[model samples]
Target: MSKKPTLRDVSRVTGLSMWTVSRALGDLSGVSSDTRETVRQAAAELGYVPNRVAQELRKNTRRSVAVITASTSNYYYINMMKGIQRTLRPTGRTAVVADIAAEGVYTRELEDATVQDLIQSRAAGVIATLTLSLDSVELLEKWDIPVVFVDSDPPAEAAMVPAITMDNFAASVEVGAHLAGHGYRDWLFLAYPSRWSTRADRERGIRHASERFQANLEVIESENDVESAYATLSAHLDHGSLPRAIVAANNPMVHGALRVLHERSFAVPDQVALIGYDDFDWAPLLNPALTVLDQDSEDIGVQAAQILTRIIEDQIQSERNGRPPRPAYQPADRRRVEPRLIVRRSCGC
Candidate 1:
């Protein structure tokens, strides 16, 4: 059996010194850009692959950042990717997405990573969107990689991982207040239970305002998809119990709840009002139009990327300054981007 060619083969084939080959392939500043391209082409021609681990040990630049998101089906996540791309494109950093799809009949979106997978990806840094198991977090910590959490809060111990998220609690509060302004006191918050910080924050915001409005607010836990929402609401409808107003956590739930109400011949904003979080483009097209919390999707991505980039730059600087690459600061500093309330007929506002 023939063994694979090495960087030495690339150097010989490209008529470059081993040191020049190494510097070119490593994308170091000392090598001319054209020389780097020529060496890369020669390596490809000779089927010579550089050893990433070997190069990492010798301090090479990382070409990619890892992004683990709960699902790609959600438009919010799709929009968030747009944000990430906007930030990463010009900087030459590309994202490798790990989207964990939900199994059937599940609502709370979560992701768990096997250590082998994490080790194999060799991601220089990680950006996670939803809830990752404590074990996964611990594993990443042990690997000593930078992490930036988005749309979810990091634990107290992970203070170095800066978080970018919508103001869930505040958004909920705004929704509840808006519903109250429309003269509805009985409200139901359709949600999914998750360890993810967004759930708890949203609950905090909604509950606080619900109390302030002196309204009877209840939580309706449902699976992440539309079918689960239909089932949950159907069960409630069977008992002839319905809140005067409903605030769904995301777009799918809003549509699902609306479907059930329509099936039962309930007049929207009259028999019941509807509001939701994470505004969708289709919201205004709904018969009565949905009132919602407008999350700044692109902005969220840009800010997160910028923060992570700054962190990485600082780490590189610290290395130059004789400091070891530190784990992102402890006790992640959370930045809560505000969600704008888009009032429409759904809330009778």
Candidate 2:
């Protein structure tokens, strides 16, 4: 087979200097439109593909932002990614996901390794879905790689870092209040592990609401995936009677609870009612439409991306000005989005 074409081949074919070819291909300011088009047509004819790794190595900058997350199977990440990608598109940057919990489990070691990998690649910025360890946060900060948390908070020690999260406590309170409105005296909460920062607040709100409404509340923890959710809830149900209502903490938990109920031939909102966090496309399509607290995950993702982009740009400008390129995080960088409960058949609405 023939060897792959390179920039030198494009320069040779276009009868232009390598610098001009590089500028035209990169769409930098120096190249005129006519010459840029000529270089592009010749490169296309020659099947020349720019080597991004080499380009980054030469420029000493990264063009991709890393998104740190766990539980890649969760549907919430899908819309969140859509928002991140859409926001990054016009900026000429890309988003790369690094799933620390690819096996449906999260470990400190995995988180460390993922952060190390991002640092090695010189990621421009990070948007994390789980609170990273303080060590990881400090390491990224040391490298001048800013992190913006989305749907999660930064480690408490790193308070100045930016974050965009929904008011999970209030959201959970609404969930509990809605269930209480249906007079669901015995309530079950299917929750993901507290490794996710939002879990504590969500559980706190649920507990407060349960006390306020005088409901009997049971909280069960599961790994952040559908299968684990199914197994955990199934085992719980095997030992006890179903509660009057179930509140699933997120998409995976919701799926798991629904699967267990369906397999057992349980009629939703009849003998038992169900509600979930994070609305998705198929939530309304289910036989008994799922009532959910819509966190507007996409908007959160957009805000997180925008925040990271601004920080990265600021760092770049600082570097250009011959200053230390540290992330300039302000108190106002911490933001919260409100969640709205969508009533549907599943919640006995």
TM-score of each: 0.75, 0.83
**Clash pairs detected, candidate 2:** none
Best by TM-score: 2
Cα displacement (Å) at residue 153, model 1: 1.0
The lDDT per prediction is: 0.74, 0.88
Q: How well does model 2 score by local distance difference test?
A: 0.88
- Please give, for residues 174-259, the per-residue lDDT of candidate 1 as tens digits: 78878888889898888865644688888888899989999998887876667778888888778858789988887667867988
Q: Which residue ranges in model 2 land beyond 4 Å of their true spot?
A: 1-58
Per-residue lDDT of candidate 2, residues 109-206 (tens digit): 99988898887677899999999999999988866789999888888889799988888888888888888888789999999999998999999999
After superposition on all CA atoms, what RMSD does each candidate show versus the true structure? 8.8, 10.4
